[model samples]
Target: MKKEWVFGTVIGISLVLGACGAASTSDDYDPNEAGAEDIEPDMAGFVMDQDENRILVVTPMDEETAKEGRAMWVSEAPEGLWIGKQVEVWVDGAIAESFPEQATAERVQELEMSEVEGADLKASEALSTALSEADRENILAVELLAFDQQADQWTVKLKERGDSQGEWKTIVKDEK
Candidate 1:
């Protein structure tokens, strides 16, 4: 009877420890790993709703280039921007590790789709229109990333080289 009681106690303690170890493993999991299910918002799309901070985007394959019908929540809204325009976003990960995943945006960028020979369409004019006065001053260069038709805008990536030298900060801009 003594041996049996000792064995049972050992088993119970081992089970408790094992359960704790399993929980810790999940808590320490990194979302940025290669096999992680985190979505990469490398493709361009449109703003679905500004109030909700959501963007409608598609994950494009190198060849296929169209995943279609996907929307995610943004963490912050880019300034001077509204809904119904083309925008790009950087998502952190799924809101929950479950099926039919929902994404949370880390950054949001507006894009310019239509171009007309006017003050609003010109790069200098468009830049001012796209970004606030503070943002424009920090930007060094702008590069056109891709054209998103659904958003009806041209996706552009901007960079502000920190000191006219090595380090740079990237900013996203859109033309209304």
Candidate 2:
């Protein structure tokens, strides 16, 4: 009986070890690799920030609209109808720097205004305090529709938030 127990333990350990060995492991495996598949913005896109560390996380939503869309940063309470505000957006997870110039806290009081909903809320006012330029630029826009009930989270669309340089660019027109 003791021998059987010992043998069983050995076999179990071997099977576990074999399973682990069979599974592929990359020392360079990146948790952030999935970020690329989530957000599809015209420029650089949004990020979920936690203190000094910010990462591009995917949203759960399938369809996106001009008035309603996803968000990365989660606040305790609804940030309140986000609208026109000058924001410094980025796409591939850029950080603060200088070359052309750092995008300081510029107030985008007026969005060129796309199918993207325009609201009275300022970007600075709607967003959390002290946001990185990457976060601001990454944001597509705030929704004007029924978003009050949505739990704070981001969503990806079958299509990206289409826009035209703050201009009201034409989306899909009904084909007659």
Candidate 3:
């Protein structure tokens, strides 16, 4: 009787461990992988602060008592993503567990808007021109180009979205 019980217990333990390994969601993903697949934002929102080679998106909360907004991170800013522009992003992994959670975006898409949606046509045109004129070899992506009301300036920063040296530049509001 003791031998039968002990054997059964060992077999159960082995089966449980084997099942756990087989069911892992991250088997295809390595958190430490240098180049992980880009995420498509499961959460979508307006671009908040584009700082630190990441775009902070402010997503709305469903519960009234919950914080009015949640901030998520996107490693690469899609073409034409600027302050006030809307975007939908999907993450590669879970957001970092911290005071403000953040996740790396696998994919990003600019939300189309009608005129009533507060679309900035003039700014959009100008941005397109700037991007075309920029030195492609050096500037991988333009993370942000927003006017700072307090500073009375237009903040422009650039960085290598993939594999290049990051750069930052400030364009005075009137200088443009």
Error of 3 at 126 (Å): 14
- Cα lDDT of candidate 2 equals 0.32
**Residue-wise lDDT of candidate 3 within 11-45, one digit each (tens)?**
99999999888844665775447876554447776
lDDT of 2 by residue, 72-132 (tens): 3322211333322222233333323322222222111122323323333322233322232
lDDT (Cα, tens digit) per residue for candidate 1, span 1-176:
99999999999999999988883447756656777776555435544333444433322222244222333445445555454456667666656433223567666666665654322233434333333322433322333344444454434444333345222222323344
**Better candidate number, 2 or 3, judged by lDDT:** 3
Model 3 alpha-carbon miss at residue 141, Å? 24
| Winning candidate number (lDDT) | 3
Using TM-score as the measure, name the better of candidate 1 and candidate 3. Answer: 3
Model 1: CA > 4 A from native:
1-43, 52-67, 95-101, 117-176
Full ranking by TM-score: 3, 1, 2
Provide the global lDDT of candidate 1 against the true structure: 0.46
| Model 2 steric clash pairs | 44-90, 44-91, 45-91, 45-138, 85-108, 86-108, 88-137, 89-137, 112-166, 113-166
RMSD of each: 15.7, 16.3, 13.0
Each candidate structure's TM-score, on Cα atoms with residue i matched to residue i, is: 0.32, 0.21, 0.40
